[model samples]
Target: MANPVQFLSQVRDQAAKITWPTRREVVTTTIMVFIMATLAAIFFFLVDIAIRTGLTWLLGSVS
Candidate 1:
């Protein structure tokens, strides 16, 4: 098993080698994710409403 101290040092070294994203890049990516999520939610909401309306009409016709 590796020693805890050695494992920690390895982790630190790996982290240091990573090239972190700039603030602008992070913000743009975040905005894109939000836009996609919002569009998905809107699409699902419309589908749900359509399904509910169809079911209600069918039930109403049967009664």
Candidate 2:
């Protein structure tokens, strides 16, 4: 098992090996995530409306 100093040194070495995303990549992904989230919200809203309408019509017919 590594001692504390050796473990910290290993961690530092691993951190240095990380490849961070470019600004353009980060911006593009952020925009895509927002767009997808918006589309998903719209889809769920429409589905909820449809289900509610269906249930209302069915219950009304039973009465």
Candidate 3:
């Protein structure tokens, strides 16, 4: 096993190197994610409706 003290020192050094995003960047990215997710949900909903309608018509016409 490695030395505990040395391991702790290395962990601290690595942690210090991290560059966190600015508040503005975080807000902008979060907003973009929400917008994209909404668009995707709408698109899928429309596609599902179209498929269901097509299937219903096809099955009904066969009767």
TM-score of each: 0.79, 0.90, 0.94
Q: Model 1: runs farther than 4 Å from truth?
A: none
Q: List where candidate 2 sits over 4 angstroms from the true fold.
A: none
TM-score of model 1 vs. true structure: 0.79
lDDT (10s digit) by residue, model 1, range 1-63: 789999999999999999989999999999999999999999999999999999999999999
Candidate 2's displacement at residue 21, Å, is: 0.7
How far is 24's C-alpha from truth in model 2 (Å)? 0.6
Worst 10-residue lDDT window for candidate 2 reads 12-21
Best by lDDT: 2
Across 5-63, the per-residue lDDT of candidate 2 in tens digits comes to 99999999999999999999999999999999999999999999999999999999999
Per-residue CA lDDT of candidate 3, range 1-63, in tens?
Answer: 669999999999999999999999999999999999999999999999999999999999999
Kindly report which residue pairs in candidate 2 clash with one another: none
Full ranking by TM-score: 3, 2, 1
Which residue pairs show collisions in model 1? Answer: none
The Cα local distance difference test for each model comes to: 0.99, 1.00, 0.98
